[model samples]
Target: MATLMLQGTGSDVGKSVLVAGLCRALSNRGLRVMPFKPQNMSNNAAVTSDGGEIGRAQALQAIAARVELHSDMNPVLLKPQADRQSQLIVHGKVRGILGSSNFREARRNLLPQVMESYYRLSKQCDIVMVEGAGSPAEINLREGDIANMGFARVANVPVVLVGDIDRGGVIAAIAGTKMVIDSADSAMIHGFIINKFRGDPALFEDGYQSIEQISGWRGYGIVPWLSDAVRLPSEDAVILEKPVSSAKKRQIIACPILPRIANFDDLDPLKLEPEVELVMVPPGTPIPAEAALIILPGSKATIADMSAIRDQGWDIDMLSHHRRGGAIWGICGGYQMLGRTISDPHGIEGPIRDIAGLGLLDIATELAPLKELKAVRGTAFDEVLEGYEMHVGITSGADCKRPFALLQRQRPEGAISADGLVIGTYCHGFLGSTALRRAMLQRLRINSDGRDYVASVDAALDNIASELERYVDIDGLLRIAAGAGQ
Candidate 1:
């Protein structure tokens, strides 16, 4: 089996996107390719075919490779609950919360588990493309690092470093990484790829040669800016800081950018609608008054994010929107916040206490230790919608009598107010279904475009693969993966 790992000079340097594109390109060549990440820290997660959860990026890469989703793709996932603490997931199951200090020691001990997953995946695929988390240049973090160089060293995987030229300092970032790291780690990186280049690539020919001269690493070709990336689901919440769309004269769909928002990609389908303008209301900004729909997205910490909404005065603004006959929808943790009461007596998320909810739905929820992870199909407004459930609360009350959808054609899921203005559900990715999206738009008295969201995503993957094949050295990369060049 052949293996190649992609490590970046820093975070958000297009490493994940490059891996997805490469996976697609390689799979298109009739190669059995698989993507792996020893460790990942992100709240955006996706349910796998094995009835478990992994980082959302791995799930997207699996789709690109045309393979089944598996928890082994991402063995160690850390979902940040606070600045210093996170919930650790091992082998697709919650292992409990760990503070910053303890997590380091725990990570060192988890190396065997990570290797086990990597070996199992390598045995089944012709090529395994591994993605490194953050940078391998952080010497302080290199001691117990299972994310980057540490994993590369033990797994005997050749590494190709990537730097974002659009951010500038591409030469220093690449050469500087070589200067700081140990000789063994530095030797693992055989070549470098410059990503997100907007202007002429020839203009940077001198700068690219400078990096090759300084680091003694070959140039792996520069990748131009990918415009179709916006169609793919972003794995990081940092992307929410920027504007989603610049279009005007369209219906507005406003969503509050919670501090710990998870699965905010749930709004991606809505953003693609030509008739809708998706606005992510940042902190301290009130939800737009003219927004036809106010959506509360899923959160990693429901209680804390709920408190943050009140602190930002979004609660009052949402009430005003509701009074004006605007539609409101909440998913997952947001659904918990829309209920009458949210109780966590066991302190699953923090301090043990019960807090009042938005009171829009006459239901009550109690946070539990066990998380619900399942793939579901249902019908809402006479349209079929399929999604997954990843939550930790159980809800019940009078409003449930008017359920928002019939899940699995028998069980009722979610709750709707008697007035039919507010809807809440634990299901994520409901809008990905074309029929459901059209029905939702019709409910708001808007004409539906009836676009197939799944087809759009597939087309975006194909576009990216074509871009990679055009610029990247595919045969050279394959040789590097086979250890022929090294």
Candidate 2:
């Protein structure tokens, strides 16, 4: 088995998409490929087939590789719930909370577990596509780092540095990485790939050569801006920092961008609706009164996000919108916040034990040790809704009588209000269903484009794979991977 790692010159340099494209390219060549990330820090998570969660990006890569999602793909996940504290997940289960104080030491100790995952993946695949989080340039974090060169050196995996040309510092980002990182660490990096080039590739020929000359790294390829990437599920909330869609449409759907929002991509499918505008309301912005539907999104820390909602006075906006006859929906943690109260007696989410909910539904939630993680299928909106349930908490009350969907085994999932104006469900990816998306849009009295969203994403993977095959040196990368353990 062989392995090659892709590390970025800086954060968001297109490592995740590049890895996914490369995974599909290699898999198309009849190579058994598996994607691996030693450590990832993102609130956006995907429930794996093994009843654990991994970074959403790895899940996309696995899909590109035509393999089942595995928690071992990302062994250590840090979900930031606060400025300094993070929720720690190991091998598909929540271990505990990690604060700034013990973050380094805790990660340092997990090197063994990370390697365990890497070796297990190696046993099952001909080549493993390893992804590095952030940049290896941050020498300050290199002490106990498993996200970048630290893992590269320990595993003896060759690294290919990726720099973002669209960011306007491609030369410095690539060459300077070599200047800043230790000599021993720099030895792991064998080549560089320039990503997100907007203009003619010929315009930057000299610059690309300069990077190779200065960094003493071989040039892999220069990738053009991928417009289809918008169709893929984003792996980080940094994409949300951009302003809301300015497109004018017939109906409006509003959602708040919570501080610790997880799986927010559940709404990405809705963005494809031409007649509907999906507005993501940021902090200090009121939920638009013109929106026909208001969606309370999922959060990593329910109570804290609820507190933040109230702090932002969105609670008042929701009530006023409700009186005006606007529909409301909640998913996962948002479902918990729609209830009467949420109690965390065990302090699972810090000192805030119990907090008042929006009281839109009669249900109440109690946080428990065991997390609910599974794929589910059922009929909702008169369409077959196939999605996953990944959350922590037990919710039940009179609203349960009006279950949103009749899941398998006659199990009731979610709750619907008596007036049919409010609905809440624990299932994520509900909107990914084309029919469900059409149903939701029909409620807004708009028409869906009737696109098979799931298949579209699948096609997108193949498309990206074709691009990588054309531009990137897949054979060269394979040769490097073949050199592993030599």
Candidate 1 lDDT: 0.91
Error of 1 at 359 (Å): 0.3
State the displacement of the C-alpha of residue 375, model 1, in Å, after optimal TM-score superposition.
0.8
* Candidate number achieving the greatest lDDT relative to the actual structure: 1
- The local distance difference test score of each candidate is 0.91, 0.90
CA error at residue 24 for candidate 1, angstroms: 0.3
Residue 248 shift from truth in candidate 1, angstroms: 4.0
| Model 1 spans with C-alpha error above 4 angstroms | 484-486
Give the alpha carbon lDDT tens digit for every residue of 1-486 in model 2.
889999998888899999999998899999999999999999889989999999999999999999999999999999998879999999989999999999999999999999999999999999999999999999999999988988888889999999998878889888889999989999898999989988788888999889888989999888888877878999889888876555576688899999888899999888777787888889999999899899998899999999999999999999888889889999999999989999998787887489999999989999987888899999987798999988889999999889999888878899998888889999999898898889877876779997887888888889888887887888888899998866
Across 72-166, the per-residue lDDT of candidate 1 in tens digits comes to 99999999988899999998989999898798899999999999999999889999999999999988899889999999998889999999999
TM-scores, all candidates, are 0.98, 0.98
> Model 1, poorest ten-residue lDDT window?
241-250
